[model samples]
Target: MPFSSSSSSSSSSSSPDSKYNLTSAIRAQTQFLTHAYTSHNLVIASYMKNMDNQPPRHEGSTFGHRVIHCDREEADRRLWNDYFSEYPKYSEAMFRRRFRMSRNLFIRIANVVKGHDNYFVQRNDRIGRLGLSTLQKVTAAFRVLAYGIPADEYIQIGESTTIESLKRFCRAIVDVFGERYLRAPDANDVARLLQIGEKRGFLGMLGSLDCMHWTWKNCPTAWAGQYAGRSREPTIILEVVADYDFWIWHAHFGMPGSNTGINVLEGSYLFSNLANGIAPPCHYVIQGQQYHTGYYLADGIYPKWSTLVQTIHEPRGPKKKLFAMMQEACRKDVERAFGVLQSRFAIVKGPTRFWDKCVLHDMMSSCIIMHTMIIEDERDEQADIQGWKEAPTPEVDIARDENIIFQEFLARHRQIKDKEAHYALCNALIEHLWE
Candidate 1:
């Protein structure tokens, strides 16, 4: 019992030492952890300092952007010295061929467009650098439409700028010239057309009707089935009625259907005013039967409607042969117009690169309007068109009750859709052409 007591006393005395040893070890570990944590913090601070030492970058964009110095003012100077100066480097014919318009006409168009849209006017960048001049912008847009090339082909003008310019230019042309140039045939116009038709052997023939197709390269995949016909190529159709002078009086575009003038004609506005009884007076006698409405000479694809006159398919007699020859010869007016239109604005001739249908519509409308303007300007140089221009516009009567007007409109609509009138007109035309 005394030995046990002595051992317990010894253990009790050594316990304090063992506890001190353990506490020292824990303190050492905590010190080491603190040092390691300080080192980690220092490393993180150094990494962040390195990050801050790098060059600042633009927000939402990466560093190392490229900049090409373009002396656009010099480009404008060169353009003026080459084309607009008193003694220019290019000839008038060269100017007309390259620009697809006269210098005066280009100037007039530029001035008008600049006035209509502020985008055409020259402006400064945020850095106070002068941007492209009016001449440069218009040239880019016009050349793109005239050549069907990429907009970046212009000297120093970027593709984005040129594209924007082309968009605005097309819109301005539509707003400025669409009303005056792209119009239905009025009384004077109908009279002049009838006079030309009389000389060509048809009495009430207004113009030739046809349709053309434009390949849509960027058509949406969802619409491939609807727009793609037998060719399996997505295309948009344009239906037009043009005269011998390349004047397109009626145009219905953007329908995806057969280019044979039948499907497109179903929804066309060619005879809207006529069927509504508000059309210009067109009274002409064919074989002792007077036709109060004019007709368009279409190919065999169109329906037998009084407003549209088609040629005989298999003519077994001499009269039909003569009529077919004359009709076919005259019906080429619209085709020739299509050829010239394609030749002028090669954009429509080539595959369309735009995806938006509304943009395509604007582009087409602008092209057609510009085409009609060119025709009028060119025809104005002739003495005969001047006489037609001098003809007085016919007066329209504004007096009519609503019921009577509606009745007349229905009557005209029925007359336009009359198959008997179509047959009678065809027979009379055959006899007239034979005579």
Candidate 2:
């Protein structure tokens, strides 16, 4: 345990003790290296696993989250479904069937109008930089008829179309439909309708006619006197006539009330025909005056003319009661036509807010034309006129059968009866006319 320095030195130099210290130092260095190596390997393995699990970064997904860009095809399909659903009665296929028109038809018609040489020449300019497809224009025009949306909304729906294009499309459709459908009755057509009415027991009646008023939003300050009425608003007047079949024969619009009814009537070609002795022959004596016989059913607001049948008043007595009833019945055709028109094209249901009188006139005329077309399209004549000509009995069941059919017609059009006023007026008019 206690040795001399020399002996300790000699033993340290040659004995295993010397080697033990050297081996220990070597082992310490090796152990440290092994621990560092194992730790580094573990760290590298963990980093590699994380890198394997991580997703590749995308620009859209990295910051704002993944965005779904809908394909144009899908967008169009959805929009079409939405548009189709708005009219439950018409499926996409049914609409195609009933209209008997295609995208190509719309395009062709649009091309005729849009590429019109006359229009370009008149404008003295080339086509506008922005243009809609013929199909788009037709669709826009029909959208106005079908939905009556505002111009701005229509433009938005039409995507790239401008308000001017929408207006032009409307005008084009009107012009086309007017030429094809709103044509004035030829002598033959007039004669045919008259004969049909006569066969239905409506004697001497050319047509049932009436007038309606639409309020105007922007009355010209200088022309207020000509346009303003007791309603304290400026308004435009529209006179429309329908035959017994509820087919519109004529429409006269844009007359100011400052013009008397007689004046307005005189301005129409319809009235000109009567003045020129072109009316049919069927004579009825009125107040001791015998006139060439043709009758027009009108409202109480109209003056009694030899040619115009008015509801009987109280002074006309018992015979007048029958006349009033007949007059009311005939005049009902015009009212029913108006109701159907207003119901189908809701744009005319309320006061028109158009700022321009000319535009208003076109809008009203277009509405009338469109209304007539729809009536022609939708009416079931066989059902409407069935058994209307049976002779009236003392105890005629006016409230049964045909009368029920008439009521159903009104109901189908979502019309309500003005029961109290209508019956009273009927009784009074009948009493007067019969007397």
Task: Give the alpha carbon lDDT tens digit for every residue of 1-435 in model 1.
Answer: 999999999999999999999999999999999999999999999999998998765443346665556778878888898788889999889889888888889999999999999998889988899989898999888888988875443456887888888899999998998888779988888888887788789998899999898999999999887888767899999989999899999888889843445668878888888777578888789788877788989899888998888888988899998998888999999999999999999999999999999888889999999898888778855544434433455466764699888887888888888999899899999888777
State the lDDT of candidate 2 residue by residue for 1-435, as single tens digits.
Answer: 456887888877888877889999999999999999999999999999998898854445357555443243343344345433454444646654433333344335546666642331122115333333333344555555445553333323333343445456556556767675555555445455555655544544668878776776667788778887667777777788887666777788888756655666666665554443333334433334443435577776665454455665663555655566666887898888887677655657766655777666666666676566555555686754454333222222335577776665564223112344334433433433445
The per-residue C-alpha lDDT of model 2 at residue 312 equals 52
lDDT of each: 0.85, 0.57
Off by over 4 Å in 1: 1-64, 151-154, 258-260, 380-404
Cα-lDDT of candidate 1: 0.85
Candidate 1: residue 74 Cα off by (Å): 1.4
RMSD of each: 6.7, 23.5
- What TM-score does candidate 1 reach? 0.85
Q: lDDT of candidate 2? A: 0.57
The best candidate by lDDT is 1
Q: Could you estimate the TM-score for every candidate?
A: 0.85, 0.57
Look at candidate 1 and give me any clashing residue pairs: none
